[model samples]
Target: MEPLIISTRPGVRHHQLDPVGPGLTGRVFAIPLPTTPLLTDALPYVDWSDAYAVLTPLGAPCRDPQEWAEAIFQGPALWVRALFGVRELVVRLVGIEPGGGHAFATVNWRRDEVLVGTDQRHLGFRASVLVEPGRVALSTVVQVRNRRGRGYFALVRRIHPWVVRSMLARASRTMAGPS
Candidate 1:
């Protein structure tokens, strides 16, 4: 894949610079690649999928945005990883085409905090991944010292594993499909 061509302007965040975890120092988002484009290739770089599963956890949908936001404010919350199970369609992050043939765009998916590094430094956070078209969401997080001090984290962390496993049960359906 060609080097990701992202625009670099002061305070201008690109698709690669928004998925940053704030206040959740060391907190991670973990995703899995099933040897398919739907999940693995869709990410900027499958390497981003790497993470200490023991320390990182992810879930399907945010049960309560309010509650989930509170936890993120305290630390890092799991990001929803969606994979396409289209038996006939080959899904993967891709660049637009006009003259040159389409090519795969590398996406990183570590602990859900996908980071697409940037060549320029005069822009927004350089971290991102394309979950899907029109449904992509980049993230940025703050680092908090007392991650477990928040009530929301307490509740989610307590059931983080269960939630992740449960969510994994239907990871493909985590998101309500292309909108």
Candidate 2:
């Protein structure tokens, strides 16, 4: 499989929501899998821990939906701690509810996209899939919501592209199984 790339423009599936500034968004052309199954079943199988380890020098992986909920609300503290060996304060914890064919959560209740964070920082991380005749188009969009977010974004911006790509690749490989 080829590498997934992040785009400056919103992905085709990501356009369901209007743009809010130049939020980081991108898509990957997978080997054409069913979008529904990919989201509900296959996505969870992606080796997120390993991927994060490689991508950001962090050990935290969103292993499950509940864990994802916690991680999101807590921001990148867990990953930061794993990388730096120091624990940061938990700024806030938001509630996660079922909606829009995906789990939705928010901090500061800003519009355009959904993510977890406090007033000082807001992040949007969403995953969706669009299936074509033979392959699946996987996409995600990330948005930052505060001044604190700016600093965080600056650090991750360079690697954000690879982060998405590796995540998609891991998920695809998991769906495909051992070669």
Candidate 3:
């Protein structure tokens, strides 16, 4: 398979970095690789830890969902308990567990698109991958439902583009073979 290249979509927030709706921000990044193989090779293994690996220097806590879940389910480290008193708290803190707490466990898959999201009292987020002719696209739509969500996105907005880019870069590297 050919390596994936990041392509830009017109009117798509990926490279454009624009708001998609009221209090909702979105970005669309293109992948040069074909859709099916890309999803097959990429989605199942993608995770916050993977994103953290690429975006860590940017100051993300980089907590692994499984580790955190384990901390809650089995036994927890003192710090883990202190940081997140309950699993629900962790979800609120982390924006929802990517890959559904397991590899691709919570994804809503379709013929050409895959959607994963979480809605909380303060925020809602939905990320999707749309397969297109000759390329694949990845996008995220985030909605801040309350004051707390607003503050969080405000702090994260500055780095959101970088995080998205790093994620695309990582995906490209992973799917296309390191470049």
Q: Top TM-score: which candidate number?
A: 3
Candidate 3 Cα misplacement greater than 4 A, ranges = 1-15, 18-107, 177-179
lDDT of 1 by residue, 83-120 (tens): 11221132222211111111112233443234333221
Better of 2 and 3 by lDDT: 3
- In model 3, how large is the Cα lDDT of residue 8? 29
Worst 10 residues of 3 by lDDT: 47-56
lDDT of 3: 0.39
Per-prediction TM-score to the true structure, in the order listed: 0.20, 0.35, 0.44
Candidate 1 RMSD to the real structure: 18.8
Query: Candidate 2, residues 56-147: lDDT per residue as tens digits?
Result: 11222213333323333233333433432221222222322212312233321112222222222344444433323322233443455556
- Model 1 weakest lDDT span, ten residues long: 95-104
User: lDDT for every model?
Assistant: 0.26, 0.32, 0.39
lDDT of 3 at 13: 26
Candidate ranking under TM-score, highest first, comes to 3, 2, 1
Sort all candidates by lDDT, best to worst: 3, 2, 1
lDDT of 2: 0.32
